[model samples]
Target chain A: MPATQEINIQKLGLIAGGGNLPAYLLSICKDKGIEPFIVGFDGQTDSELMDGHCHQWAEFGAVGKIISFFKSNDVTDLVMIGGVKRPPLTQIKPDLKAVKILSRLGLRALGDNDLLSVLKEELEGEGFTLHGIQDFCDRLLVQEGALGRFQPEADDWIDIELGLKVSQEIGSLDIGQSVIVQNGMIVGVEAVEGTDALIDRCSALQQNGRGGILIKTRKPQQDKALDMPTIGVQTIVNAHKAGLAGIVLHANNVIVADIKTVAKYADKYKLFVIGAPIDKKSKSVTERTPKA
Target chain B: MPATQEINIQKLGLIAGGGNLPAYLLSICKDKGIEPFIVGFDGQTDSELMDGHCHQWAEFGAVGKIISFFKSNDVTDLVMIGGVKRPPLTQIKPDLKAVKILSRLGLRALGDNDLLSVLKEELEGEGFTLHGIQDFCDRLLVQEGALGRFQPEADDWIDIELGLKVSQEIGSLDIGQSVIVQNGMIVGVEAVEGTDALIDRCSALQQNGRGGILIKTRKPQQDKALDMPTIGVQTIVNAHKAGLAGIVLHANNVIVADIKTVAKYADKYKLFVIGAPIDKKSKSVTERTPKA
Candidate 1:
């Protein structure tokens, strides 16, 4: 988004999880002179970050309390930020309203994406505008070019394309949004285990120090407002630890938490960070950002 | 496959690698009064087992010497048995003929499957009848049903089906032939690291003791006579170690080495061994062996 774009929203609701993304979003809201009301999760949200910001804490599966907190604050616009560790259903102490929601969506077979989508729909049904974090913080999205000093080599580009293709299939299945490829073979596919663990596992299995490329993209059917693929300095650091050659992400489709720090880390590690262009014609193949 | 069938071929060639499969094949040949000529890779083949047998040792990629050794032994039919750790190209001391073959097929970009297929074609060109191990030892193929005392529960069946679907897609891309799915989510997909490693990774990521199902099948375009998916006692032991609920193999398409021991292991571990039937219309989805 252009810097000159005028903001119209007055009150924004932030559903915060773990990571610096939530704090960054809050800071952005403050800079734009918008009132931010935060609904933090019990074990996920960073407590210190939300100290002075009007916020309420709820258990991971306390859907009823989360919805009520937003409604009581008269917040009409909401964006879920950061990541939540998927809590076990048995541990979730659901209220009557949460029970109703859980009953409607059978808990036995729902994957993370499916459950998030259900919650997003439920929140939207309550007369609130569900906003993708990008709406308020588009600067976080990386541009379409190399972010660091290094550019992908010819072979690295081939691996990047292969990773993209495999990641699309992975996303289509709602498995996960990252794949590591090297020497024209898929080294790893992200599943329930997140990207860091995936890269760590790949590193253990990688032959020698011959590095692979890591690709992170949005799931084909993912709810943009709920969870978009987010990468930051830690991703670059982890990729380096994993002995990966580079990292490729879809431009305008992924949130690069802090591009400057991320680029600095990439340069320090001699790793290329390329923002792959999303094919607009095939929206499903490469996830699209929410339309303003 | 039936014991009543009389053997006509006098000499059988075995390209041995690490595992009980090659030894099992040789023993079968011995019982059937057929001469077993072994071409063993130095590092991979079980040295002690082939000690007294008529065998010749060659480096992993000594393609020329392997073919020549088979020819000198008057072995017209050949079966590549068990797994060989992929040797680095720099370590491969290819003879003049092997160099010629490698040069014709530029070695830089070929995957394991592609390279194996190329070798299979080259061997066939030399007038040797390449046989899937099943061709000579059909009794090793699992019959469709519950092979052990335990049957797959309903949820286990669901995970098995999910694994089959994912494994098919993985195979179609010529990545790997196995997938582990538990609680309706893919835990792991086999790649270059192979099945035992894949299961080990899945076991690490698996939540609780709720073991998933492991499905192994043939790649869509895989040359069956070259490198068919093989499972045996070790596979059962590893699956048991991985805390997997059961093992599912495409009936007839997979080689079940030492079936009695495998079944015994399955029963002891209370793990179901299922021979899932392949849909005739979709040959790539699940592999089916010839019914006895």
Candidate 2:
């Protein structure tokens, strides 16, 4: 057998969301002979990502500590992986420095997007380069064409097109990803409750019929490094229960955590899975603009 | 004392959403000496509405029967009241006639709007006139002006303007009525979750010291009689908990379920309550263009 190619790998900073992506990314980094330092938010960062891959760590509400850890360890670049629950307020205990920064942000600035933006700016100001997770984890990026059994009928494509466009606009608002569309109409959109609950809501709307399509994608003006969109086999399972016809994600921008498993499940459900690249010209205005 | 002009009320119908609106409308209907008939949804109609005010009624699963209930009771006109939860599927024991209607609607026809739109068409097809909840209870309509001690500042008005326009656009989609905004940014939106849950989610988003605002209004194309927006004292209480600045509802289209009690709570929280009449000129697309 031919020897595996050896490549130069640089150290990486990992801001993990609660999922297997971080662990998988770390394993890839290790195989590439790269070191990864981890920082996680409470209730969001998967603990499994810390399985002998990280060099430094810190918790949520300890933004300053995270910065300090990254600095002390000399980690200058990072990747934010997967998705997370909206921060739980019950367990948060902000340190002094974190409190001062937080206090200056007016009530409106305290929203999740604004808060995350603030953190991003602070880290950037400190001389660390934050690259989109997809920048390094090329293996996790989505590919084009149908990976599942169902390639979608003509009608399903119409709804899929509509759902994909609407979800991206919703993302631009920083509301959430994952919208349920059926017969060219959006039935439900995921907000604070996330995708699972949104699917449940969509299922309730359908009496017993199945024609809806589930769409997930990147935000229009998305900051990818801080929020890498993701999907899994479970998403396929949820789509099946909701009577969904197809599933769509942004090619390259979206992460498929366990592509093999997800692909198999999609095959079993006859659900189409496609990684659609953003058309540069159409990025400004989505194709399926909702009727006014 | 000027003799109070008693409403020479006839052909009046009371539309109510859950909570206290139905009972309140019923009492008002009784005082006026009108035998108020109701067209209420099952699982949503207060048991009280069925027992006291309605001379004719039928559950949602039986729209075919409802048309006859109104006509047989000599109810020449009708109104819709009280919001219904999405009907639970497990309880869908549709009568044969309802099954016929259900067959007419495809998978895309989900939620109350789709079903109600079809019902309205079918009812008109049968010569029954549908009406809004505020038709008889004119006193429940919000007056144009600030209704409490607190008044909106410049920034609050800016947000109000932004929200008002966005809410209308969202309304056109038939997506929802309430939107949570902060510092000219939308934080959370009401999509099937209703008002209270919208506020709860917006509150959870408070991370940088930014509280938010909640805006509720009627959809531009919404048939006035079937659904006029509403809020009450409890709305103010929820606003206070959610760390909101004010509440904005359409001056004419919305009902403050209890004005005096709601005003009292607004005073306590120093929450501004603005009731702007739907812009009279904004009926067409040109006028509907959102103000800069």
Candidate 3:
């Protein structure tokens, strides 16, 4: 949770995956005069992002190559960003280092959180200090209160509270990080299909009256240094398309990529975007805005 | 739960909703020589199911008319069957009786389970004995063990165990009754979209190696006299189409509509259909069949 200004970035290694967040991070590095050595995944990371950077493309299973690339460039600080689909074990042709790690981990079924945790440990074990995306840029972190002009009503706050409780319960099990609730009923919960798909599926299942709301939060047991729950401009667009009334994210714990553009779209669509703090005791959300 | 044979059902009243369960229940009544006074919901119950049977179509909000119709037929034993979409409050134009009941209940957000629970209480208060579908037909109740030629492998069982735990967790919150799991990851959980849509959504998210397994159970706090988690022939077909290896249902709790055809389809598609007993203490499933 240290401020971006306090962190010294000297020859950082960026493991970029799919999404706009990686490109955003790259821009931040440019602004700060830090040239990060980027390691892009074969099918996951966008090839276009690697155009004018010191980067190397590696398969997800090429753990040895990724490590050596970072080591060769003297990049001691590492940051893993963006989304990567969990491929089946059969599909991943792990190199010697990855095979050794997989074997040591006992090859049981691993969720995204578990996989990332293992990766963090492995990289740290090899004498590299891994950093979260938040460590590089504090601007990307979601702030408290409504980001857009619109604010959720009293009834909407009730749904938000319920959604927070449900999302946290599911997150404790490492299932998913987002949930859609309309009225008092949960329309849908995000799983492996991702948040956008969850919104699309729940659109057809919404009840007759008021639209649903999307609540995204970090998993309770999730490592912040690993994958933090993220929301972007695309999320607002999807929520508007799905007739969602608003979007809620756990304050500070969630990453809001391109916050200005996200706020613009949310305002344009008249959807409220609020980042609320989680009440640890009740395991629910507390609305910061006083009722008018 | 009383045995179906022990319950003397004379002049039964059925409040039929959508899906094949209502039709299936009607056929059972015909077989047992119990002429049920059918009260079908408008836009919900199948029209064909009412042919040759003493039935009346009533809107969901016309509680007064439905009650009088059943009373006129001297039918005191009532059973609410099939699925009914939870309409928005604006959509429902409730009669005086329904309005009184709803107002007395102080309508907050009511899920399907809560709605059904309210209906059960209202009906019983009006001198009607509420009986579950299981009261008229025990044959439809799922039995313990595999129903098809195929049985789940060890890995599938492991996934089933994980699915059971997750589904129960969601069910306890009255969120969902079914969850799809592959390896150790949850692919999707059913909400208002239902089991079929959940299967369809999870198909694209499945891992490459082995297919996922669908685990369905009754919500822990759900009333037995209300809607039971049901699986029909179409469920088996959909599971197979989704490349699911098998399905596991809570034994004796879930309703298996047209079980014979369900078994036939399961065997034809080489998908295992199992009814596993849930261990209440652990809130997990116990595999009844011994591993070979």
Candidate 4:
């Protein structure tokens, strides 16, 4: 449904990935007045998003086609959302462009962060501006303070302190960015399995006991646009299952889906929620400005 | 099959609890020298070690008897090895003396390090010198180098950097003592489940096309005799299973079990066994003497 007005939308780009995030963004944009162009990834970056948003789409291999589409359509302000979910290197058969990216990254002595940064640099050098998910929605960003009635105790603060230090250090290494710390000892840290498993195992470690704290953050310099750390309803559910005492968001920098429902869920579970104050000693994966 | 010259082995005191560690320690001590006095933890400490190490052992509630046993006997040096696995708060039927000691540790603390440190202090206050596992075996103190023919690669050095930084920060929280980094990204960090599980998971992550490297160290001010970092044949085996490229241990400070076999296994798997050179950055957890 292209907008049929003097301002009829015909020029936009949607760098899509395997998530509802891009689809939602593109749908909203199309509904308003713009037709979204698409740049998709293989094995990731949802295919259905192509139906919703692509004036021209790539099979992750067709980078040249994606660039040509955007250039021909006079699309500017490229918004890359979601991610290609780190492909299975052994099975990947990249197209020439992706092959170039991969071989360059592999050969340039680049680690994960180095590769990511250089990729961002290379893309920008090709006239694409980097835009984070925050550019779309304001409510997605977590706010300050306990979102619900459950208040944190001093002990929770201690665990938060301990969890933050551990999480940040791990995050800086490009590992998963989350840790379950109970009474200043980490019960679990996320490996490749992700956060839910970490929380699940922590419950077992706690022996169904109460008082565990879950801290989730982002990896350092992990291109906020590429991988904005997110927590959602499943997080609250996991916290309840894990007997976690509270949830601490990195003030305003992190993303949480649906605040009201999450707050209600926390209340239902009697889980304490605190918007951790960011100061010199404390920093989340995204270091939000210190709360006034 | 007791020692030929048994000197007052009648008053055995086994600080028994949890896993094969204390059990093995007890068996060797009893088989070689005198019997031991026992101390059992209901939930965390394994009680079965008592059967092998102690002449007579009771359940967890026998704190009074344990104190009395130490008092009655001329036992001086106390060994605190193997972790409690879990602190059995539900089984706390403390004697007056034990109750007094418990009162000193207020709430807001459940970390293993804090608990162990407090226990050590209380025992020392009562004129008991807390000893480590090293008191039993001189050879267990591993030397700084590859135990096998395999040497670490340049990439392994990068992983070591990431691993050391992350592990030290985790240690600073007194949360965990190990982190697995591969290709300058963390694959796992040891929380409650010890290093073996960490090794296996990181390896699996790599087998799924993610690389794996492991780092293990101790918290600063940690009583080395208690849970001094150890690696054994099982560690090498796990590393091999996980497809780990290398392991970076703190030089000279770590323990590698069965050096000859460990080296052979490492060589078989083409694994790199390295003792990471100590630098100022690695002292995040505790103080270290710069060696020649």
Candidate 5:
């Protein structure tokens, strides 16, 4: 009998940040018979994620060391997941490689998208393939249909459309990614405070306990591979606590973590979770497009 | 010598809301040798402002009653001033005349300016002249200069410009009247929430106690006689509490409730108060255009 054919697994480099996402991704990689190597930022990645895993700590801006470490592990494919507290320039002790990337980007590096795009390009130039998290965990993307029992009322759809228009306009300005719309009026636009604070502020401004919908989408000029708008169980919980009607997200443009758990909490709270396909031409959300 | 011709005093109508502005306007009318008649809205006009004055209370949407009250007092010139809590649609019990007005201006009846414009037309149709609050109280307009010890640094000016562009864009959409910008990033955009709430939201989002500027401007399509952006001592106090650097206003556009008190508070808090002349062509605030 012929000997069993030797099997080879593709090695992936995981740039981990804070939260359970990295660990979840690692488990998925193992289940899929893929080799995983992790490099966690000093103050960002969760320690639990590093347990019994091939992981090492590096300062956020130590680009050269990160690349070399990944190379030594034969990692040519990379995915960056989870959140990082954007540190001030003073806190970022960049190595020479990072400084070169920053200087070359110049004023265009003012926004998060621009900076991340530059990093993506740098990694590609060094012969690394940068993949979006969805590449490994496509199931985590929100499905097209309503997640829970509750569906949006007609008036809620009106508010959702209004939110889509205004949030898109603001996103076009590169100002923010989310907006709170209630009764066809904009309640708040997210800026530096981010989604959680935006939700809190909108909740406080509710009139007669009337809740609104939180709509988040990708910035018009954003690179799809980096910094897509992300939501998870915490987002659903926050919206529920804030008395929000539901959440509307652009299909193929937003990421959801632990989607089953998110759907469970949403169902418990009777919150609607929908993945809307936004029509750029009509500037409105079209029919739902189910994820492939 | 022939007997001196009989002096005639113009009868001016004061449509007052909740605040010290109506009383201040009344006093200015007295000093200017004009007879004033006050028409206050129920739950909106302060008792102190109506005390010892020829005034009557009417529901906010009681256009017929308001017109009749002014006509009985022989008031030809009218000025609307101060704040009115925007009542919900259910709360607005519009009289017959107001219903007619609202119907005529279908979609335009949505915002403050459109309603005020319709009111102005109705009053003008009956031979009443609508006068701006500034006409009677021009001294309340903020002069184009730094009002306190702490002047805006050059970097603050960059933020101020970015804010002006953004605020104007949002204003054109009739979304809000104020925006808070810090470190060249938009901190918050005021919508249903008023200026104070916007400031508080910005303050809470500050990293390392870094403060920003609060910019208030006139809506591009807003009627000057209706609802001009007005700031007062409380605005300065709130900005100070929020750890904001200063306040920026449009010259000859924003109303200061009590210029002296606002200036005093600004000085005490070491905050700068400057009135900028926005150049529509250049989309930037030009040099100081001091109030006359």
Candidate 6:
């Protein structure tokens, strides 16, 4: 993973999509005195985030125009951030460049991660170096410890372990990155429904007594340059609303949009938010104890 | 898989839980002129299913009494049928026999399948041969071919293939039995919430244009004698209500609780219900075309 100091901030390009992540990244760029060239997608990117920032708006399939916009602005270091609802292929009217890229991807179906990786390769081929959100702001990366005042108990650890195992298994298949486990039983696994909806759906299904815990991790085959599992203050609020006891995320492999606010929300809801150092092979926490 | 002819119907025992499966099995037993000794769970089993039947009701944790009830009735073959909401472990008051059985299960956590397999072994050790519902009535098993007028189009088949692949992957991990796929993206996967809830949750998340298809299969590590994926008229109705185009189930491996009614509902709702002969290793349908 490239640290902030190693990356060139000059002529940075932000491929913004929906959600607070784009806005959060914009704030970080502003703080560093780097006004990034922003590319916003129609209906997907929040327009408010691009206000007063050098940016271009285009349809999701306008690959040719999107690339030219970044190239003309001398933007080489690019970061794609935020959520984009995958539209049906029929609805996307791809330009010549996008069509060529799609053709190179072949007729076979592509999972979400696969599509992102292919897009990353295509962008890199166009002479831009793709970077993960962590490249600009490493502080957004979750560290190994409990973020809030609360800590997971012994039984919660067991559920967290099971959740990590299941999350990795699903992630390896390019399925999803989050799973809800309660009392050793997986209550729900997120697919295209996203994390918030997954939390909402699992609330009614949780077994009686102790609440479930949400576990989020990066896919084993995931290209960090393309995407990484992310959470924010909204995630904490949703987890708390779902009656979940806490949330466990893979340390250094997930992006926390607003760390301070997230921690404050977690504490307010009496929920433990911990980042665990995960062993990729074993899908287990490398260290059992949380740092004080 | 044992056929209906091979299994002896004499002194059959039906361990009934909740859902239409219990009552359906009971009706089958009556039709076969065999008055099965039925053991119903107090809260889990519907009392209506036990009316006018030779049955005894007990709490879910009354392992000793449940065994003696079957043993004293001279029930050599037992069939555990229907759905049971898994209660928190702390709520269960294990009897002496259950305590011994639980001890034998060891201290490690067990998934639903593992727990069922362990219980099957314990019962077999107690001189009762456990059989799946298929043993009593193989007609309930879904056969290869479309069950209704509608047939899946090319796009739907592609989605079905994707669904099967994901379903098998999840199943191999003992995670889920069903998956919903639309436009090459998996919308949802069933976990502890079961298939119905999975469909309902995916309904809102489905992409625009065509609706998704539901694919169900037996878990790769699943014990057929212990349990198999079972769907009924309610499943068809739910799929229809969820805006699903069709349902593809693994033939022979999945049980159709009431096939005729399910087919009727499928046809009435303009939904396709097909059973494909699945190659478990490849997780692909062996026969592609629907039988006329």
Fnat across every predicted model, in order: 0.40, 0.09, 0.88, 0.68, 0.44, 0.84
Every candidate's lDDT: 0.79, 0.69, 0.87, 0.66, 0.79, 0.84
Chain A TM-score of model 6 comes to 0.94
Candidate 1 chain A: 10-residue stretch with minimal lDDT: A283-292
Superposition error at A247 for model 4 (Å): 2.8
Write one digit per residue (lDDT tens) for candidate 1, span A1-292: 3552334798988888898888888888889888889888877888886677778888877888888888888889888888986765456787877788888877442578887888788888888778777777647777777898988776466567668877887888777899888776788888777898888888876655458889988877887778899998989999999899989997777899988989999999999998886564553224433121
lDDT of 2 by residue, B1-292 (tens): 1222334546555444477877877777777777777766555666666675555445556665666667777766666666765554446666766677678876445545666677677667778777665666566778767788877665566567667766775676677888877665666667666788778667766545446678888887777656677898888999999888889888777889889889989998989887865554653112222222
TM-score of chain A of each: 0.91, 0.84, 0.95, 0.82, 0.90, 0.94
How far off is model 6, as Cα RMSD? 2.0
Q: Give DockQ per model, in order.
A: 0.43, 0.15, 0.78, 0.45, 0.39, 0.79
Model 2, position B256, has a per-residue lDDT of 92
Highest lDDT against the true fold, candidate: 3
| Comparison by lDDT, 2 against 6, better one | 6
Q: List the residue pairs that clash in candidate 3.
A: none
Worst 10 residues of 6 chain A by lDDT: A1-10
TM-score of each: 0.89, 0.70, 0.95, 0.81, 0.87, 0.96
Instruction: Order candidates by lDDT, high to low.
Output: 3, 6, 1, 5, 2, 4
Ranking by TM-score: 6, 3, 1, 5, 4, 2
Query: What is the per-residue lDDT of model 3 for residues A9-112, given as tens digits with 9 covering 90 to 100?
Result: 76778888888888888887888888889999888889998888889988878999999999999999988888888778678889999999999986453777
Interface RMSD of 1: 2.6
Show how many residue pairs clash in every candidate, following the order shown. 3, 14, 0, 18, 0, 0
For residue A181, what is the lDDT in candidate 3?
A: 94
Per-residue alpha-carbon lDDT of candidate 6 for residues B160-274, written as tens digits (9 for 90 to 100) = 7778888988998778899999888888989988898898888888878888999999888888786789998899999988999999998888999878888899999999998
* Per-residue lDDT of model 1, residues B137-160, tens digit only: 658677778778888776566567
* Candidate 3 error regions (>4 Å): A1-5, A107-109, A287-292, B1-5, B107-109, B287-292
lDDT of 6 by residue, A1-292 (tens): 3455546576678888788888877787778877689999888888887888888988878889999999898888999888777677878888999899888776543577777777788899988999888877768788878898988987687788888988998898778999999887888999988899899988998888889999999888988776678999999989988999999999888988879999999999999999887786677766555433
